[model samples]
Target: MWGRSVPSAHRTGRWDTGGVASCFGSTVEQTASPGRKRGQPGACWDQTGANGTKRVADCRHESHTSHQTRLPQRSRTGPARETPAINHSGIKRSFTAWRASRRGKGLDIGRPPEHDLRSIMNAILYVDRTGIPWRYLPHDFAPWETVYGYFAAWQKEGVFDQLNGLLRRLVRETEGRHGEPSACVLDAQSVKTSSNVPAAGQGIDAGKKIAGRKRHIGVDTLGLLLAVWVTAASVSDNAGGMHLMSHIAATHPRVTKAWADTGYRTKAIEHGARLGIDVEVVQREPGTKGFKVIPRRWVVERTFGWFMHHRRLARDYETHPHRSEAMIHIAMIDLISRRLTRESTPNWRDT
Candidate 1:
């Protein structure tokens, strides 16, 4: 028969071909056909059609052919897709060197990670800098969950605190200063909490009238962060001072004196005495009404201002205060890394 011919089916049953299979009926010719030869085209029998008229159709020349042709070509081998490394605010070589020297001292959790620590740290900084939720991390970086998991782990391990301490020492040494400061400044800022921050994690600051958390910080005379602590906003400066003093004592043994404002005068003195450190209060000028920069106290205030420049620090969104502390360390690393690089570079303008 002309065109393609289909085989006669003894019973009506559906057939499925991996590819589209066109249905064809027997030719109208009276002669029964033999098996198709190699030279003939492929065909299928269609006995279930409404009309019993014999029909012939080609299966290879159907509409579905276009779809098969459009499929991607199979490949034998290629490099697997990988998450790109984050370069922006990534760990510097100096910082890496410092971390390596200190790595075995801590962070010795058994098996290694799939992603490099540098990439993970950069991913974390990217999240903090952009103020995005953990799940919203860009696909180009390591998986958001992985990055956050490492962040939380490191936070609990006090890795960020170690980084902040080590980097601060390096910065101070580069500036021809002692690795440890003898005197430090104390201050606190009350920041409102975001919707993500639970009510259980927050309290109202009666003084600032802010319902959130208070960031209590200790900075060296050079305004470098020595310690950072977060507490409920309702915690008075005196109460926060006790925690801050204890933290400073543990981390910065060389810090013998701390300067603060009137809010911390009595508590600072009392705590400092117990810790064997002197506390000095720098009171605002009696007649000064607005914006007087009190000496010693202004240094810590300026440090707080620097923290404000980071969008993530504008409000407390972290459910845990430890995460907030890690973010602070990340921000300071960004700042001090740039400063260290600039100082090492020669002044082209002067030349």
Candidate 2:
């Protein structure tokens, strides 16, 4: 009976090697032992062969086993942090603070309007520092047209002349309390222009080869810009001498002596006599003297150098001479600012 029952069980294909009951397909191996439940999903077993050799087998479903081998999913966070906006007003306030720290005794003109003054001054400084054309100013600041308009308005209103006068008075008062300047330097520089403005025939000097305008600058012993005048470029340096000396006398009453090159020899002496300034020419040696440079008179040369640093001043581009003159004043203000702040670092290295 036991042999008949075993044959019936085998005939049912429960133990055939090529059937579903084969070792590869059957679940019998998982439930053969009464004490063991099908081990939780991915169980492994150690089986002993009849000769006592051991082998390891996995009881896991193929899908579950493959799923366990994959990498973990990642989170989706964004990119890097950004910087904050600049406080331009705060920067201007800081500059004003620095200006206040260095301010000496003077008439109180309570601070200028924040935006307008700052923008205008910035435009001037930009022109002087970068030596760029006014029309080419960057858009972040005031438009070039606006700045130039304000400059022209100020010139028409005599704002620059007034400011210069005020600075001169302050210096003169200080000098009066101390002593007179030893010597003043006089010189005229010509700015070639395509300007079509008409001026008096007396204002035109044919000798300078300049037909449009001239700027005569006078500097004191300390190389401070004392006075400036704008006239037809045809105006002779001698012709402009009297007016420059008059301006100096009016601005700096205590100037004792003046110096110039041969250009200012004739009329300068006459004007200096009236103003009580002894005019002396820095003489050049005779012969083909390979461009003999004069001392003391170089202060005006230095002033011209300062103006030439601005491209607009390098060539007059304005339709009006007064506009060009206003730009020159702006240049002077920039020079004063740089000198006072000790910010005159050269932008290029000598090559």
Candidate 3:
């Protein structure tokens, strides 16, 4: 009635303001009733106080802050600075060399890529190392779809496979070994998968007690990947070993001997003999207890340890077996490329 009139509550439990309601059930008096300014209106802020109770106070004037006032744009004194591309110089160099020296180089005819190839590679590696979804890729890189398209295309075309081989050869030579390994180690790692992976693509691993997929891979003594085969976790070790041996035979013919854990015994050994690779089983010492590393088989085991260094390999996320295998190849490609170029990979320990 004077400075500010508090709304009167009626029998119906509604606050009476003649006819209108605004901030909440309490209505603001539009026309000035007494000493209050024109813009001031009673409000219930729709928020809790520090003590966690609602407080209704006398009308206060506040700005809507919805662009009603014009803001001046800052005047630029120099050209805008672009963000540096994510590609490491080593990765860029390795990919460039592979593209130039690889067979069928003439087939690269096209309108040329809209995004930088190095940038594309950086994006792919980002997803692998971070274990993020394709859509969650950082905005600084190419659009997720474009980057994934390039990944899918390159993976389907065996680009990663070839790149892995090139990097393997370079790393082997750097270690004073021949480009092609005459002996190798074989192993499998079973990991759980995301819910999006269908039951058709997943199976329970009775041995490791993991439910998802298994990665069977062959690697040289230097711990570089030679071949990878992805299968449902339920698949027998012998089956995975057979497929892995076949892949290695087709790709690395010079391999004459292989070492495996006891899991790959008769069928796998027989298959390797048929393919001309003498498979030898590396057994643990009779009375050993905890985590003793066996001879020869330790190389493939070390390769799996390297896989855990990349977060994506901690679990199987791909919908297809082939794409899952490609992820392993991509991990090795990133590792070997950096190793050959003497580039250090960054980790959480970096300041």
Candidate 4:
């Protein structure tokens, strides 16, 4: 059995040392005279010296009053900790201006917003940059659920798509090119999916031996995104190309020619022609052994490389392919906004 005088535990703040002291936390207490006033005699703990002499050590004393009255002590050992905050560098003034103008012109009659839309947009950029789960969002921004709610509503409403398309035109015009391209490069990439991705939304690419989904994209000579389509990996290039042409025709009908690899040679060309696009297949030379740069084809490949810079696009994690496509647009929006506004590159390493 232990001695009755064995330290039961110590008190902290206004908490007494007893049955529930351990649950509150192990604390060091100071001895005060019974005649001293409450505020005059602060709590302190006894420390043993090297010579085994008992000495009183000072401790911050907090009363049972409200939290506002308590002040935390400063330590010389290290800097004080703070909740992490998302960076605002990813947001551009021009982008915000465009959004405000668009919102004012189209829909300004809704009830007042509970949260700032800019905060939600920054939260999304933070998530896309860090590739973190929605639940793990930092406490500084709006709640993750609220941010995701805005993202889903905007995605379904094609808000990002419209913004990206407008920015692409503005960027092209600034570069002394036509706002609408007469020619584009077509390409498809197979991205593996996460384990949580459902089979109904993804399939295996037999040629690439990748079990995932395929993203077929059309980009102008400047490597800016023009159109995008997502499909199961099992869909052949020709089949996916046909679907993508319809989208391009509807969205970017000014594209009269599309440069592609040999995989989209015959039927793909015929289908594109029927949709009023001349599909030019860039075939590899027969004598080439290893590396050969095909003309115009590398532009689309380079655009895909740009997409790879975003960690969220490295794999298909969304359960719905449409959501995955929306994520790609979100990534492209960040890229294009920076290009158009000369904004500094976002510091993703902070998180």
- Number of clashing pairs per prediction, in order: 0, 4, 0, 3
What's the TM-score of every candidate structure?
0.66, 0.59, 0.69, 0.69
Tens-digit lDDT track for model 1 on 1-351? Answer: 123343443123322231232324323221112344433443334433677534354344542464556667888554554555656555476667776776668878877547777789889888767778889888878998899889889988988878888888899999899998888888899999899888888999898889999998888988988888888898888877878889889877888888888888675688799998898888777789978878888888888887776778889888898888888888887767767765432233444
Q: Give Cα-based local distance difference scores for all models.
A: 0.75, 0.65, 0.80, 0.77
The best-first sequence of candidates by TM-score reads 4, 3, 1, 2
- Say which prediction, candidate 2 or candidate 4, comes out ahead on lDDT: 4
Q: Write candidate 3's Cα lDDT for 1-351 as tens digits.
A: 222343442232433232233333554554423333433454423235788644353233222221223345669855565654667888779877876765356676766567877789999999998899999998899999999999999999999999999989988888888999999898888899988888999999998898899888888998899988898999988998899889899888999999988899799999999999999998888999989878888777888888888888898889889999889999999888878766786566663
Q: Write the per-residue lDDT of candidate 2 for residues 123-216, one digit (tens) a residue.
A: 8668755656678889877888788777768889978766655554455455563334556898887766643444442144467555556888
lDDT value for model 2: 0.65
Most lDDT-accurate candidate: 3
125-204 per-residue lDDT for model 4 (tens digits): 88776678888999989998899999999999999899888999999999998899888888899999998898888888
Which residue ranges in model 1 land beyond 4 Å of their true spot?
1-113, 343-351
Relative to the true structure, candidate 4 reaches a TM of 0.69
Q: Which residue pairs does candidate 4 place in steric collision?
A: 29-44, 29-45, 30-44
Candidate 4 versus truth, CA RMSD in Å, comes to 8.9
TM-score of 3: 0.69
